[model samples]
Target: MSEHGVDSNQIRELGRQALGDAHLQEAYRSSTLRLYTHRLAAVSEVPGFERLRERARELKREVMDHLDFYLAQFAENVERRGGIVHWAESAEEARSIVGEIARRAGASEVVKAKTMVSEEIELNPALEKAGIRPFETDLGEFILQLSGERPAHIVAPAIHMTRHDVSDLFVHNLHSQPTEVPEQLTAIARRALREKFASAGMGLSGANFAVAETGTVVVIENEGNIRFCTTAPRVHVALIGIEKLIPRLADLAVFLRLLGRSGTGQKLTVYTSLLTGPRRPGEDGPEEMHVVLIDNGRIATLADEKMREALYCIRCGACLNTCPVYRKIGGHAYGWVYSGPIGALVTPQLTGIQNARELPFASSLCGACRDVCPVKINIPDLLLHLRSEAQERAPAPTPSGAALGERTTIRLWAWAMKRPWAYSLGSRLARWGQRLLARGGWIRKIPMYPASGWTDGRDLPALARKTFRERWTEIEKQ
Candidate 1:
């Protein structure tokens, strides 16, 4: 179990459940395909999109290389701008830091913009435990909060849900008249959350990017809620992962361009807020601004050269939209906050491979994620690397007498493959053996250990009637 109490080992079972639900499958298929298509269309409009990706990759690499210097500079600049910077080495520390800050401010409630890092650290539950209520201001997040469900996608938290699902949830929780219209649902959530925003003592958010040179925290969103979350309350706190920093303010534009296009097919998100610090004497913003820089295993990822590229992820979730495995299983199956291809890489590393050994193997390794990644992260390569690390660290399986038959079968197959005569004989025999099970040019079931597993989910094409060598020989004679 991870610190979050999520077991990555249960991924297969969770994936199975996800696959069996037709509604869930349709939801994932539609949402991901739409996002994938949008991203392609958006990227095509940019003549140097690949160059942009390469540039983004280079900038992230620079940050990862000199992370310490940039972090210190960012902290100094933030402090200079009157924003307090809190360092948290782990999830518990981060939660504690934020909780303490809330307590000091005498905040009984906090209005939060959509921030994955807060979810990563399980801050909501901690806040509840600390006798504070945290309201999720994002529409999708708000729906999920009402339902007591975890996010199913990084970008679209309630991607697994439908309009009907949201309507039903709103009717049940908000006591609003059920309506499937998108605008109606938005109004229902907004009406409920507006009160929370007005009454909450503090505003909480996660930084999309924090500029080292200018001491700025950048947040982008389509809705205007983030603006309210940062401005409406007396106190505002931003939870940022250590990897969210960029070297300079000038570089923010490059990422903003990539993030919007890659995430939602927009030229730019509707509201891009640059927060430097708390409000000045007559300003209409929070009186106090705090930024919690949480490591929570990012430093460990940084130390490993092979896995460092995972940090370059801007959380745009383009990889998730393009990943086949993620499209099928969805985000929750990976059993952690960050899900999809990037989640598979980040989860095992952040939570330890022993706890999340199955995540590295949960991919088809199709390289779709690699192709769509805004920062040009070679996700397939990194997944393979994590698979190796998981295997290396995995305990050796115990010898079992129940496996004797399988071992003998493998040995015989290996022996037969080494000799032409034996190989030919084996294929001929297999053709004869499959005659009983073969139907409609495919073998639907083999009724055996290994082959049965394959046949359970797939059909095997029946072997050809004539051998290739025999056909070639006949052709030569003709």
Candidate 2:
């Protein structure tokens, strides 16, 4: 339904557009490579990284299995410690809850650290509609806000933009002198955001992990803005997906070790803040703390047998960096907040199978993402499962007539594949038919319907004159 040609239905089109943009391709390639290399080095330095990954995986499984109990326990602890917890069953409910909170606080502006949940609910627009301006305090998020763009990558957010692109944006929007140096650009962002941090009435953030036993919301960041957001404002709001819950405080050690290394290759992120509740007497924290537990399709995802492992994702984005498809065509092509291999598997369930049918098929099934996953999520298997679900759920009829043509074609192919003589005959016919289109070992064009899209960007390799089965029989006779 996206008129912008970036929706799930237009995955091929979005990819083609991204591939044509030289700057975007270069930016994506370099940034992904750098992050990928750093992650490798950092994980290598840690002793028994594989064992640590297995422990993290086990912890995730434990949380998912008893999510309701842990959630109730977490809510009780939070409320007991002078903090409030809000449960949101839907994205609209989440935005309404946050908007009401912001309105009650008489907030004019709020400083927000990078919270993907907030993005999930489109919270900034809700705040704006309620006359509260939400400022993105994280550097990458701030850049995106200034440029009026959504996050292209989950971890980096602005990875698709080059230094020169940022330089132009700052110069045009901030009225700052253009500078292409990364350090100077960062400094400029730091200076601009410091004012927002000091003046904002409330701070908003997302939790990386929320411990059930202790009611602690753990945030890891290198920018120091998350700390500032939590401490500087009179009121603090933390939005977290229900899946972020872990059973015990002690479990933090394994996750903390893996998150930083897997995400950005840091042994530990520069700042790891654990906020329990509102500021105590004579404490330098917010006077009020609010935690919004969002379940917009997450509970549905948890129930899905094929997709439950997706909840184990820590959002480290190691999968994105290692994904060949993501490398070729950055995250915007996915047309959602989350992207990459995890996105393909999780987005369909998070959004809907019908809405995101193309996502599962976008991958090359290279299994690189599964290899790098800290929690060992089998993404390729999940994708294939979703593909079957999508196929099963697809409507059998179009507005004009039956949608049975493609299905019939597939059935005919399957029938032929089961019969040796029919399969051989089909192969021989295909080879002869392809001769007209074949040029220099590739099929430059396919006059056939549906197959026409195959040659839009990449060529299809021509079929051989002899089938492999026939060649094998000939060799045996010889």
Q: What is the lDDT of residue 26 in candidate 2?
A: 97
Question: After aligning candidate 2 to the native by TM-score, how far in Å is the CA of 220 from where it should be?
Answer: 0.4
RMSD of each: 3.1, 2.7
The numbered model that scores best in lDDT is 1
Instruction: Please list the C-alpha lDDT of all candidates, in the order they appear.
Output: 0.90, 0.89
Once superposed on the true structure, which residue ranges of model 2 sit more than 4 Å away at CA? 1-6, 395-404, 432-444, 449-462, 471-474
Candidate 2 global TM-score: 0.94
Compute each candidate's TM-score over C-alphas: 0.91, 0.94
- On residues 1-478, what C-alpha lDDT tens digit does candidate 2 reach at each position? 4632237656778899999999899999999999999999999999999999999999999999999999999999999999999999998999998888888888799999998888778888778888899999898999999987778888899999999999999999888999998999999898888888888889999999999998999999998999999989988999999999999999999999999999999999999999999999988999889999999999999998768999999999999999999999899888777889988877778777776788998988999999999999999999889888978995323222333476777889899989989998888898988888889889877755566667756789999877778799879899
Q: Note the residue pairs that clash in candidate 1.
A: none
Most TM-score-accurate candidate: 2
